[model samples]
Target: MSKDYPALTRDIAQYTGELRKLVPETMHSFYALSRAAGANGRIDAKTKELIALAIGITQRCDGCIGFHIKALHGMGASREEVAEVAAMSIYMGGGPALMYAADALRAFDQFDVPAV
Candidate 1:
């Protein structure tokens, strides 16, 4: 079955916000780490996002797939680029990764429309 990626990300965001309220310090630190890891150093932000998306697919995390695909879309990542990453994930992660990689591509297509 097809997934509602936008709704999935939105629901995750709402719950994440709630978690932030419950564990402010831990969540703040995690956000800080995310920012630091995602920041451009030698690699560009788009590349970093691509790598993250690939990892997400390999790990089979639906939330990661949705969020990273959304971010990649906002960063102007073409479908070709995401497809390449999906291929790489499938290569490394085998059958399970293939499943999530397809889902990642679906997420990318879902976000291809105007930003919600």
Candidate 2:
């Protein structure tokens, strides 16, 4: 069955907020690190999000895919761009990655932000 990307994102955010409250210092540090890692550097944020999406696919992490797809959609990534990234993820990770890559593409297409 297809997942609901927007609802998944909202749930993640709500759960994460509660987790943050439960472990304020730890969650704060993790959030700080996440922001730092996602900051634009040699690679632009768009490319970085693509890379993250690929990693998410390769790792088979649904939450990771949702987050990265949302970020990619927000950054105005094209469907073609997402497809190319998914291709690379499949190349690197083989069969298991294929499943998550499909999921990632679906998430990208269903995200609230439009693809370019």
Candidate 3:
């Protein structure tokens, strides 16, 4: 079954806000590392987000799936692009990955993105 992605996104935001308050320095460090990882290098930010989305499916991390899908949506990734990444995840991870790929696609479809 797929998750309610809008709810997931909202919950993540709330949880992150609370976590930041609890450990602001660690949270800032984590955010800095995340930014560094996503910075333009051999791969662009959009590609990195797509890779993160695929890995989230492979790893079956619902929170990771929500985060990366939101990032991909914000980056203007098409549904077809998400599908391609999902296909690769399925190929790499087999049946279980297929299940989470469905979840990822559901998030991609339902996640609320702000208009640019």
Candidate 4:
């Protein structure tokens, strides 16, 4: 469903005090399907990060862009992988994806490395 993402995010965040609270509950079917996609599949976490990156780019979600970038790094995705996802997104989602993709790249560069 097409939505004004900014308004949806603000409305959810306002009610929940944080966006994460709205994640699982808001898209139950999608969440279920996502989990199912990994069941005994060859698809790896890094690939999933790319998918998430594309979704964030399409959705223009700043928080999701940052979160998925962190997820990519956690799954050992290199900068090149993140760049590839951004590149792929532009083809499908057009110019708006660039802004969100840029935020993802910036977050990847700026976020602290987790302790080993």
Model 1 lDDT per residue over 52-76, tens place: 9999999889999999999988898
Q: Which prediction has more favorable TM-score, 2 or 4?
A: 2
Q: Write the per-residue lDDT of candidate 4 for residues 29-105, one digit (tens) a residue.
A: 65677678634458775687688788988898876776577666667788887888888888888888887777667
For model 2, how does the per-residue alpha-carbon lDDT over 79-109 read when each residue is reduced to its tens digit?
8899999999999999999999999888877
**Alpha-carbon error at 72 in model 2, in Å?**
1.0
TM-score, cand. 1: 0.96
Model 4 stretches astray by more than 4 angstroms:
1-40, 112-116
Regions of model 1 farther than 4 Å from truth: none
Q: Among these predicted structures, which one has the highest lDDT?
A: 1
At residue 104, give the lDDT of candidate 1. 90
**Each candidate's lDDT (Cα)?**
0.94, 0.88, 0.90, 0.69
- Model 3: per-residue lDDT, tens digit, 3-95? 887788789899899999999999999999999999889999999999988889999999999889888888999989999999999999999
Candidate 2 lDDT at 115 equals: 41
Q: Model 3: number of clashes? A: 0
Structural similarity to truth (TM-score) of each candidate: 0.96, 0.92, 0.91, 0.64
- Give the residue spans of candidate 3 off by over 4 A: 112-116
Ranking by lDDT: 1, 3, 2, 4
TM-score of the candidate numbered 2? Answer: 0.92
> What is the number of backbone collisions in each predicted candidate, taken in the order shown?
0, 0, 0, 0
Q: Candidate 2 lDDT (Cα, whole model)?
A: 0.88
